[model samples]
Target: MEEQRVNELKDPSASKKDELLKRRKKQVGGAQGDSSGTASQGEISPEEAAEQAAVMRSQIHLFWGNMLFERSQIECKLGLHDWKKNLDVAVERFKLAGASEADISTVLKNHCSNEEAAAGHEKKVEDPISNVVDKGDN
Candidate 1:
């Protein structure tokens, strides 16, 4: 009996195909959290919802990039490598970015490196921000 079940699973023409199709139908139909296995009465179609999600994902990516760049600049200015302490300062500068504290911490922990922070400190000490503008005046 077990061997027969295995063979049926391997055969696309078997009743297993119908079962799989029914499961998929249930999942897609109830995606809107309706109890009746149908979309909410006024909910948008699946394709339109997926498109909006994609757009939101891209926007979030851009915002994350901009926030990281600004944080790097501030770290260079402060000549510090301790990003955990400076996160609040960075968050203040990026107040309009709309990122949550948890998201900012996750991004920093994943992407920010000690080497980059060290490089920022080195650049700040060697050149200094004031000297750069002064040099531009010449």
Candidate 2:
């Protein structure tokens, strides 16, 4: 159930995120503002642009989520570290697999940590402390 919730937060549909990103890309890059105050390269309105920008802003989590999806194989290949689990390896894999700093941070701190902890294999047990037994005078 928790996994389902996380997945839902991450938005499992790549295309939905992609479409938003693609539109954002066009808006930020290709869809430049017209000096003459008219739609130029794209037919998107200012209101639409604003809306897309807002949606894209909200959807930024998707970018990192998508990055995780892309690098999951590479991350798996790096395997886990005793101390850090696979996160360090995963982050490196992500970098090698072409993720940005922002992407790495988001993936590690946001998408992966809870899942890793909840998986329960990595639980650290506290070391047993020695008890000082008092010797009573006979």
Candidate 3:
């Protein structure tokens, strides 16, 4: 499965790439140095090129993936903030757009059910000072 393959992927770290580079260098053994692990000489073997290309591609993929993850996370947070800030305006606009009250209520109930449930299930805050005072009195 695609998810399984994704789960198998190791975190992109400098050490893993460094290890690959070290191995490539050992394989090259006195050849023209290529930091990307490709041989700098005129005649590059296809296998060597493919190997180096895969490494470079993976590094690039991880870099972009991290950037995307951070950007998307921030975007989602901002969206949630805007949603909470403008919910009343949004609902009023929906009414002005000729949406039925029943439909609006249904949508709001579904969207805000999580908050209602969370509020209902909130635990009572314990007072440590009260407990300590009671203990001293006892």
Candidate 4:
């Protein structure tokens, strides 16, 4: 009976394909929490809207690139040394591409190593006790 039930199950790929389709549909329909409408709904004039859009776009670009670099650094600190080097290279690329020092620092704050940070810098890990498991047989 179990074998029959398993055989009767839908193909995993089909569900995955459906999920991809749904994601595409959502993207096309202006995904939830998207501020495109909110930006347009304001009493601001078209010129103001255009300026706001440009500013938002710039912010998003910086944010996305920073996120990628910081994630790479975290991966490196967790023993992925190669990823760390790659992230450093990416940061250099950003600097060469004219990314502001403030932007770089803000993004890196979350992932910097003790040695990478200045004196008196420390990372505080919230919920450290959650990592401990009580394996005592009671």
Local accuracy by lDDT, each model: 0.54, 0.51, 0.52, 0.52
Return the clash pairs for model 1, or none: none
Please rank every candidate by TM-score, starting with the best.
3, 4, 1, 2
Kindly report which residue stretches of model 1 are placed more than 4 angstroms away from their true locations once superposed: 1-41, 81-138
How high is the lDDT of residue 69 in model 1?
55
Cand. 2 Cα-lDDT: 0.51
Q: Residue-wise lDDT of candidate 1 within 1-138, one digit each (tens)?
A: 877644432231334345545655676667747666555445555765665555455445445555655676567567777644455455443343344555455445544455577788888887877798899999
What lDDT score is found at residue 77 in candidate 3? 54
Per-residue lDDT of 28-101 in model 2, one digit per residue for the tens?
56445546555455566786677666555545544554555545535544563342533455455445434456
Q: Estimate each model's TM-score.
A: 0.30, 0.27, 0.38, 0.36
Error of 4 at 73 (Å): 2.5
lDDT of 2 at 3: 72
lDDT of 4 at 109: 61
Per model, state how many residue pairs clash. Answer: 0, 0, 0, 0
Model 1: lDDT to the true structure: 0.54
Model 3 pairs in collision: none
Supply candidate 1's per-residue lDDT for 96: 38
- The TM-score obtained by model 1 is 0.30
Give the 10-residue window scoring lowest on summed lDDT in candidate 2: 126-135
